[model samples]
Target chain A: MSTGNWLDARAGGARLSRRGVLVGGGLLVGGGLLLAGCGGRERPSIESRDVGSDRDRNKRRLREILDRQTEAVKNKDEKAYLADLDSSNSDLVEHERMVFANLRQFEFAEFGYNTRRVAAHGDYTFGPVFRITQLTADESPVGAAPAETFRYRLAPKDGRLVIAEITPASPGDQKDALLSGPPADEAWNMTPLRVVQAADNVWLVGDDSVPDLEKFAAAAAAEAAIVRRLWEGRARFPGDVMYLTRDDDNYRRWFSLGKSSNFLPEISGFQTSRTGVRQNGQVYSDQRAGAAILINLKNIRDYYSGEDPRVTMHHELAHSVTAQLRATPSIISDLGSPTWAVEGFATWATGVRWPSEASRYRSQLRNGLGSFKGLPSSKDFYGAKRSLNYLLGWSVFAYIAQIKGREAAVEFYAQVIPLNDTLEPFVELPIFDGICERTLGTSAGAFLEGWQRFVRRGAGA
Target chain B: MLMVAAIVGLLGALVAGVGAYLPTNRYQATATTVPCRRVVCIPVLKASAVIDALKAKGHPCEQERDHHWKCELMVGTLTFETTIEEVEGLISDVSVLVVRPPDEEPTEAVMDYLLWLAALPYTADEALTEEINDWVVDRIEADEDAEAEIGGYNYYVVTSNPGSIRLRVIGALR
Candidate 1:
């Protein structure tokens, strides 16, 4: 649906954001009392002396380390950035150094850490920390991306708290009440990484296998240029971070989410949105803290040998650029957009780059026209007939772009895509009709007829 | 090399002969209906007998509109509403709407009902039958839909909510 077998990577970081807000509010209230006391007002001691005190102390100490690290990043001081990590563990220190190097490649507009829930573990203290990073407008068009929460482990070394290990944060790490669970097992955090930077376009990250990493980075750079040209003014072109894994277990670990099956070759490459919290009663918020592109190297090995990688990279990059526009923070599962529009837009963009694909889609449409069931439903998109549905969907966008105009097609997509869960028994047909009439100056039926004719003409049927 | 090749051929024949008696097919198919248990093929139940079986199993069966009956049966922790269509005093088709949770286990009783509906041969052990049902459920859960023609019957399945699996069984594949 996305690029190859396009599946959107699930981001459960909203739970982390809500926790950050609560903790931030408490800190503000606590700070108010201390500030009042500083003004020479007669008040009882507001200093905590219980478990809250210990938590408060830890929070303050962690904040100081985070502050120094943030400032170091601003100054491009790699030494200062690595100084806060636990030096006793050389692996941890080395990893942080690599992390610093990786992070330094990006031109961030906003970057900081929000200290969330903290707890004691054996002799060390660990908790979930939300690392908020937003690339500059020149880089990422979407200003505020989704915040990635990581488990920052701290231990008392040399009579002070130093960073022990920073692990991939999971929904379980946000647990303070009835909701909280455990940490995640992410491939990126689990293995030693090989980071390759491709100008301002991509950071190709793989594991252990670095010989052909530069080649992939170069290809990614070329694809990124092609995506920028295709999307140009319509979408964001933030320097995307791409993960390429050789290990089947790592690929499965990264892409499988929680499914039992590990091998999914249908998934060529995918873009995961780190979805942010919806604020001000809004149904959709383009504000995501970050997004990343993951290429299933194990499954997509055949695609690499073929020319499918060019098509897949372009398609996934299209997703990465338009990631925030499709963000539906209110819904845990992104349901606002129809699978057809989402997949169709990306597929259409791919066709724009390769003219041969246009003829291919035309041929598919001509063959499938007899059994065409209006637009492909959500069922059709993920069903056994997914490939046909994908081509059929691509035809919709191709028609709109050709007949109504490309700008109109983009507008129609933007308006129709967002928040309504098509998976449920939600009536989306009327909504589609309304949007179609308003955007394309035709009823849904008329648009379908026009699309059918356009397909027939293109196919010379 | 000739002697080694001869020995390999002999071993392959031995393995194939052993495999013939392994019962790998599981469900045995006869001309029209698969035999029940070990022998003596069970006839396909009439609509009245099927209704009686459902009632005896403690499932709530009620007559809906003309010749249609709806039954409430618990499969795992999820309740399934099974709607039966009868044409001329015979069960024509059956459809089930099961809204299950993501982690819900496949139930043997439900699989048994499906087997009965299809008139397919049942596996010897109930647990083994449930295991086969689990495999089917896993396939449906992963792919969202699965279709298979087995023992003169067509099995069609579609799932939603990554949990609620709805099953529809037509009379036969042909």
Candidate 2:
């Protein structure tokens, strides 16, 4: 991509506008090129700092209202919190009530609201508003502080500015703030969330579309136990949240990859971490605070039918169990273990209940072992041979467990998958080899040879 | 003077020849404004503008359903199969199912192309349609599936399934 093209991507000009293309073409033909991409919102002019100005006075009032609301949240004062929201809009008031109730569940070290930019939209003052929060160990063990940014539309109800509406702030909002990193939409910010305690530790956070919350939660709890058993004495089982949405829009629109940038339809479930606010040298949060398992209810028809969601559920829960163990702090690039190990372990943790998976793997192995790659990497997870790669990944851990005992396999995982936030470039093969030699008393080359042999033997090749 | 007169006459002849190949005013009016042949003119709508648009864009279109034309076209560098549904002589909906290599993500150019195509039929002109396209894409990007009323036309971009995107533009007449 050219510098102009890169800028266009950043400016969201990649969303085609023929007029923009024509203009750009005209400019190029005229020998004066400009990189003003389509859909690029110009920064609103800074407001005058003059205290006497009506705009300034109103902004100050809005600031006070925001401050009061933030204090109410921190203080756990429901009345005060509800006071800041417009009373006429029963929906906003009701939503804010639920929001307040949700906020009480978390232990916040710091909580406040800061106004970055404000503009008058019709009868409402709309701007990008940010809610700064740092959760204590109750929510995040790492003391993750994230500034949730939202577009707040406030209007003067009676004599004060009250919040009329709240929507997730777009990437453009961050652009306006001159902030780095892509904006992510959390369920709380996107829609009215229903936070329910599924089990003693398992919290079910979903939207209204989630059907029979209690039933789903019970199933999720059962799966959580299976996940714990899978990682028994191997890794700590982190009691976390599970998200499910029957509403197709919510299912597709939540989290960072929403709006189909990299979203694949075939995905049934995945683990995602909601990170803290980006600051200093970090791309976003140095540590991820909130980790949740998002289940695609739209794809899984069996879930609605009350069929056992054990296989997929266990796979996702295993991820949460190993999340903290694998978290690498203070990094921009997603560099760590190869996908073979990460997903391989998860698939392996699916346990022996599903012998069909192993048989399937063996069948695939019998066919494709002729052209087996050394190991599947992170990129291979989405590749054409992903199924083969997934099975191969499972085969690695399964081989280790078979040869050296399950304890040895777990030990190998612990040694290989710990948090090592190194920026130095290194090949994964040697690292895996080194870890294998240290943990399993085998060379990386020997491991691969043995793994392939084991796979062939299992396949009767 | 005689040589200049000869040159002018030759230029006039060339202009006349080019004009002959261009779409006539009657064709444009009939295709867009007035119903041709029958009162409903559904066949004319399908045979002329909609098919012509696909053909002009180098897509091989065939009538798959009664009034539905399925065409293979290149949006950006990616080739996608599109089904355009004609309801009551108007292109009511267009669904683009992107065909990409496994593991490949949809490129911005492809997305832009899809949005532009969606906005094209309902828009009065290319320029205005482009503007609407930009807004619709941006709105959807900011929110979820976006719906907006622009220039008396209701434009919607649905991403319920990322693999296939459905674009529906309902005109005031509808």
In the range A187-268, model 1's lDDT, one tens digit per residue, is 4445666677776756777777545677776778888887766555765546677777656666656633434222344577
- DockQ for each of the predicted structures, in order? 0.01, 0.03
Measured with C-alpha atoms, the lDDT of residue B38 in candidate 1 is 29
Error of 1 at B79 (Å): 47
Tens-place lDDT per residue, model 2, A71-189, is 88878899998887779999778877877876766545567653432344443554545566554322444533456666666677787777777776555555653232335365665
lDDT of 1 at A16: 18
State the local distance difference test value for candidate 2.
0.56
TM-score to true structure, per model: 0.55, 0.54
